[model samples]
Target: MPGTVKKDVVVGLDIGTSGIAVAVLNRSSVAIQEPLGFGFCSSMIMEKGFIGDSEAAAYNVKKALDEALTAAGVPFTTAYVNVDGPELVIRHGSVKQAITRRQVVDARDLIKLQQHLCETVLPEDVLSIIQLDNIRFYIDGEYVFKPQGCRGRELGLSSTVLAAPRRQMDLIWQCLRNAGLPPTTETVVGALAVAQGVLSGVERKLGVICVDLGAGMTKVVFINHNMLYKLSIFPAGAGNITADLAVGLHTTLEAAEKVKKEYGLGLIAGDVHVPNISGSGYNTVPGSLVHKIIKSRIEEILDFVKEFIEELDLGASLPGGIVLTGGGALLNGLTEVAQEYWLMPVRIGFNSLPGEEAPNEDAYRYTTAIGLASWGTGQVYPGMRQKAEKGFKGRIKSWFR
Candidate 1:
């Protein structure tokens, strides 16, 4: 296929565990001309983050990409994609250096500084190092944001590193290639993408946590100073809830999922009353039993999330509170449960792009995919030119290397 670069068109594909979503956007402006196109596929979860059915996954990805590109009236040549799941790993580190009076620093100096920092840490594999804002430069014992052109005696660099298993990344790249699309520029969770799309600048600056309750994974990310401080993904998700319902209700998986969509809630709004099924005798299970089953599964998922947050030692760090997004975020009373568990203010997040028609109130289910596109457009085109440069090269090397 010939490479085509439409000045305004960029595509973002999210290959998730339960389904695949594709979005094509106009990068020059904020308007999303077409909403994302979605394709459903079965995710063969072999392990926490490992996907086993590459052929099936490729088909789903291609279908979504085709529909999205066709809707946007663009053909794929170069596009951004977001990858998520358990394979990726992240860590934070810092480095302190003394600056000489009247010293000049260049790009190489920055690279060397990064290399020196990299040397101190043991990375299972170094995928990318994101330089967080607020590089603290100490000039005569005071911290400053920028020290260039200033007589600084010391510099302190604090940064977060995002890495992933080499083998897992390779599999995703190969899958995308097989589907006739370029590999993703960066692999970020659906949760962080949703956080970027929904959280405000002030909220991020003040420290906020975003929880994305996806189908196969639930991700928690804490952002402060416009950078991620912590992120955790659990294998438990809406799928597990549905599975629990299926087992408890003794119904087919499809039927259980349907029931979950129709009447699912974190907390029962009223008494659980089972409607009579056509083929089965009048449902005998008490409403409280059904409610218990659902609530128990959701609580288990939340418990895992709580444990992860505690592990990160961020209970005291985020003052802006927590924002929830993704399909699972819409569960009735989820915010209340999350607030009680995390002991923070909780709000549900949705896509709010300028000039785009407000999504259906329930469309929070697609938050991650929409946010992936939004983040890709903002980061790849207008926002972080340096980061995009780094991402583009990093993605290429990750695939081929």
Candidate 2:
């Protein structure tokens, strides 16, 4: 192990169903790109979005962290992690408080309102809140971005809360602890993290839909006015497509994954030679059949997303359209299929450093990890405040911290 860097260091860890990604960031100057390293390890210890095997997940987490730290030549023991899955619960609630003491809405009123929301609106079951978004304040009935110092008798607040089962969250924390890395209070939703890494501030402000196509799940997030407006998770992803290919072509899962990476196209194209499941010979299959199988699964997944989006009725509001990210986004012609399916402009999400013209091929897969690092460094949007500061002292300390 190398000596840890003395500079301000931030780490981001994303434990996904198909793999674990680790990103180490060292901020020494204006541009913080030259000293960090990105590491990844293939893993199946996670089922959907929760850890299925704590021991195995811990081992893989250590392996990925070591790889990144070794490359960065620095050791770290803490990281901002990402959480998502079908078991996640999303709730929207509002609370109002009467400012009778001083007849004014101040930091105290805001804190009280937030406390009330958390204590009363959330599910009574054991759950860990991973994200608090879309926090808004109002004076009377009019919305206000900043509610402090207002002469109002009543203060109201509303927020979108995301929580995961406490038992599953404990398992994730144990895995990190066993991996020699202690988890922090900073946890981000997987979809929001991807949006942070790939979608520019302008895009978010103008409105955009970010679809993260992971291995076992796909997350759909709608951002407007630079705030996370909605989030939805589905059980289908690129892994489902690979499974379909394996069964349709009579091939092994491994072979199907290989074929998918090597020759999978979103549209019908040239023929493909798929290996047999018996590991004996190869079979020549028409590209159209392969595309049919792949497209069917892809369409099904996106159909759910489409229905969700249509329910939101965001017609013509999202000028930024939709951005596709995750390992599944790497599938060739994915943007094309998504565009045709949604009848809107779509592009692959890629992370790029300042002054860089093009991003590398693997950038999309690590987008969430990168975003987690950004959050650790406090590069957060104004509207994405995690929670209300306790008091004036706490708010002041946070501003300088």
Candidate 3:
């Protein structure tokens, strides 16, 4: 048998619904420079996290991977892909078991506890389980972070468990396979990667809600006391607003998208003139009407957020405020809208890495991809650690692995 050689490169591919974003990082350096390569493609044929046209999706993924590889000047294959959507499920639970009076608990026992919880609570189709914390354990009725070498007749364990459906994950795996690269790891959407890039220690400890508004989906995670409590996804996104404009104005999607980028506002309070696009005379639509359409969709999306937060009873629990990121977060008036709907202090999320200059003020669209690369190189904000899940957390950790 021949010994396998180690590869010097790590790549992070965010397979989004509206497009594909590929980021390549050099592993030998402590800081990440400009991405070795970056590529994007329109996600025209994907629906609800499934690829409708394998050929189109495969082509996009391949082009992105090839370009990233070329820019990084690395030829070795394999990548850590970020999974976008799977209707993530999260729960907090505790387990209790007896320990020998004189024996010490260890990491292996924690792993055993995790496995036991998985077997007891997770469904058969679960693609991953991330143990967020060992949390505090009750040993002989005394709570402690570490129970090793402690005498106790009873041990209680509490942790966060995050799970995703297996079918939702197959799409990403299949895409990578078609792209001529085996997936080295598969991470959950809006998880450790985003936390690494956007969250601060104070924010995590004081309690914060991170919302990633992508093109086709908006994912949210709530952190309280440095622990993740809630994760949810909404179907409506910036793409939905664009589609609404396209249909309402009877314009081509491209033109509608252009109008959105150029003049779209989430809530227009007064009358505004519509531009003379396509060399036609200025066609006017009521600012209120436009606002109504955009607001309706955005409100629906935020309503989902509210419902999820209320469901988890986290609305009052999170005090660090809300941070919004991802491509769709660039939409005009989105932060204000989120504040009004989510009823929290909202701000745009940015990536801050050592040595690398902050991106252009207007380049919020690339936050995720930039964060993806920064995260891969271990330049994330301080205090973020990879949660524990082989499929999801493991894949996220591999950027540094």
Candidate 4:
């Protein structure tokens, strides 16, 4: 077998419902300057957020990847991608080991604990664990960040596990294979990737929420103490808002989408001119009516988010507030509307690159994809980069087997 060459460049591919976003980043660059190039293509073959046709999805994925890589003047084979919606499953599990002998714990022990968690049995064969994230290690009932040198008689690992149902994994893998790429070292949950790219370290510790509104689904991510504490997917997103507008105003889906983008949260102070709805289908729907529709649906989604947070009993405690990303976040006035409903500080999430140069006006749309690339470059230690599952922490594999 040929040894894997260490990559100075990495790519993040977000196969989202509304579109597929690809971002190329330099592994050697500072965190803010890593963006090399990025691209997004509408996901025509993804039906309601799942891959309806593997061939079509792969083709689109390849096209997006090539577009970004070519623009950046970089080359790549395997890249990390995001997974969510139908194939997405999250659960909480804690695994503990008795040291038996009170001895110093080492890197080997931590790696073994993670592997043991991953290799542990699941409820069914259809599901496979991808990440044992947000792990907090404790030695002899005391929480510790660096447990490798600690002496302890007992060790515990607690984390939120990300798993994929077989079909979801297959669709994404097939797309990678058809793209002529190597098998991924591992996959990232879409919302988890978004958090990595958008939320700052301080925000994560202060507690925060990320609402990734894609065309097919809305991924709600809650973070506290710099880890993904909880996540859930709502079946509808900005696409559904477009659909509702189409039905309510008797306009075409395309026109409704345009209007939604142009005047989202439609809370403008004056009468707004409706474009694209002229001639036969022309009917002037008041700007207020449009905002009303958008606000209602958005509020409903916010309500669900509120309910979820309330369940965790941290709704009132998130000083960092909510960060909204994804293509849907581009909608005008969305941040204002979100703040109104959540009663917390709200901001549209955008990645900070090294310089003032903006890749595109809609850079926020690629938040998750940028994260995938950042993560590919070792934002997450080991990050499925090792050839062996048991590879030591900080050991970078030259290539994936």
Candidate 5:
């Protein structure tokens, strides 16, 4: 029972179209043992980031969560879940607040300024702000790192806001509730969570683009100057490549996926045997053709990233370059191809944060889940606050308004 557990636990749920992943961890700032439990279940209930069937989605979530809890010998009532979907809205805006009686700025003033920005910039009826970043506070017209002592009549704030449609979020909450997990204001952008799991402190501060190449979607998070600069999700991913192979090879999706994992290469090698659409026989196809099909789809996805980079005029500015993770990032020679296309260094990222011990090969699979757990340790979302769970302290303190 939730009341019986003596140790505080942190749970992270990474809901994706390809599967649902859960991580159970000790909620402590110091070094700890490995993850208490980890669980995953293949699911199609979610499609390209949106829940297509609430009933099916809930069932899958429960299946995964139960497995993790059973492994850990602990139970949890809430989890910090990742919100995946293409309908997320990200925008940049600025707001200003006037000081009362021209008094000196303090922590209370800073808090009020943030609250005012949240109220003025967000359309509460249509959109809910999920993450706020790139915030720069100012007194008058100049930037001030420590605004507590500055004396100014006006306070200003500029930030990037990531929001999702209220209707969609409501549906997500309902689905989780149906799974028996109470929904808290605590939530994270999937890509951002992935970055937290895989990126090093130096890498984040130097500037880098973290690309999560999941099965159904490719999510990108840009961190520069130790802050989130952008968050984007494209509707294309490894699943599309599998689909293309399925159609091109006249094979079932299952067979095509197997061929992809076995023979998919960035550059063609030689001919190989491929199973037909039916389970009956095999046929031979040029390795080049397989490469061609895979390359076309991969390029299409990378082109979206390239366009966004150019639009931001971020060319040649990011010293940390690109770090790719997610299931798709496991494809052979993908790093080389990405490096060639962007004319920059590209590397595969795995789960690097502490507290869990996973073989190198399996580390990439749980990158997002580990990151979500890391997000729960000390930092939290701005406005969403709930009373800490029994035996839990400072877990789920971050709230989304």
Candidate 6:
């Protein structure tokens, strides 16, 4: 592979239940990126992260690409795809290597160990492996991050693999191809991407859970020590809230969606006079009613987040607390709701980008897509040098040093 240069551009494509987002970034180095263009297109082809209609999904993908490419004034290349964890079948695998002598562990040693781990036997139900990231490396039975040049008698590798049903993966590829997009580098979970873009190194080390409240599904991602710890997706999402408001308020889905955003915070903030909503059914209804509806659904979604947190006993011990991202995170007063539920510090995600309004406003909704672009463009995040290095010179330097 060639090295990333000043003009090397990457695209992140986030295919969500309610819409598709595209983010284009110009990579400067291992950690620096500048936004070129961003495009967001709404579609009804996806239902809770699953593609309900393949043809419509493909067309929507193209429209999103066109929007982004035209804005950036650049041609298409391979994109990084953001597929939430629920769409994948999760598995844990580990491998061990015996070191007869206490010698310096080099990059090749780590690579071989990872290759062994990749040989993990999959269940017959698995279709294909989407992506394998992060590893709990060990030398002489002690956990380590960069294992190179360590004098140890044994090497070990442990990691989580995200795989998907073959048909589902195929449909995604077909949609991309039909959209005239290039091949994808790897599949990334949207929550994980959001975490990378939102949480800092110290925050991850302290402990943090990033929940992406997307339209179709709510995704939970746990981060610690600057590595991906766990990821999961739930069936409930902000869309459920919209549906609830639509039914409870006796309004059209569009009207309910508008009302939800306008009055979603309820009395938690204050009342807003929505003139668009009329008739006896809504004219006298206080914003509290709308808040009541939104709160009920949001509480249920937070409960789902609680289930995953319990998996690792992340209930009350997380010092870095919880960070919210994704389109669903845009709802007013959502952070307050999350804080009340967890009894922990909660905040909405914003771009880590410096000195600019996130290369565009409304960056909160596009956090996952931006993170995906970093992966698709092979641009390393601030602390992922070990995973991004490649090529003969890079290899020789590692071995010789």
Cα lDDT, all candidates: 0.61, 0.76, 0.63, 0.73, 0.75, 0.70
Please provide, for model 2 over 53-131, each residue's C-alpha lDDT reduced to its tens digit, 9 standing for 90 to 100: 8999999998988888887777664477898988888888998888766787766577667767766667455776666
Tens digits of per-residue lDDT, candidate 4, 1-401, equal 48643446778888877778888877765444466777778776765446888998888988988888887886765477787874577777777887644477866677777766654534555765555577678888888877877898888887676777766666666777787665544577878888888888899898999888777778888888777778888887888899888877777788888888888875666654444444364667778888888888888788887777787787367888898887778878888877877788888887866233335666666788888777755443454323334242212112231
lDDT of 3: 0.63
Q: Which parts of model 1 have CA positions greater than 4 angstroms off?
A: 1-6, 30-47, 75-78, 95-120, 125-157, 266-283, 308-319, 354-362, 377-397
> Residue-wise lDDT of candidate 6 within 1-401, one digit each (tens)?
47635466777888887788888887744567778787778887876556777888888888887887787787644567776536566778888898644577876777666545645534444355555677678987899866777888898878876666766666666676667665334567677777777777788898888888888888888888766778788888888898897777666688788887876664744543433334434433556778888889988898888777778876468988888887788888878877887778888776754225334545665677888876544332222332422222221111112
Identify the superior model by TM-score, candidate 3 or candidate 6. 6
After superposition, the stretches of candidate 3 with alpha carbons farther than 4 Å from their true spots are: 1-8, 32-35, 75-78, 94-113, 125-158, 266-284, 309-318, 352-362, 370-401
Between candidates 4 and 6, name the one with more favorable lDDT.
Answer: 4
| Per-candidate count of clashing residue pairs (backbone under 3 Å) | 2, 0, 0, 4, 2, 0
- In model 6, pairs of residues that clash are none
State residue 327's C-alpha deviation in candidate 2, in Å.
1.5
TM-scores vs. true structure, each candidate: 0.75, 0.82, 0.74, 0.82, 0.83, 0.79
Which of candidates 3 and 4 is the stronger one according to lDDT? Answer: 4
lDDT of 6: 0.70
lDDT of 1 by residue, 179-248 (tens): 8875334555555677877888899898887877877788888788887777777878887888787777
lDDT of 2: 0.76
Worst 10 residues of 4 by lDDT: 392-401
Better of 1 and 4 by lDDT: 4
Clashing pairs in 3: none
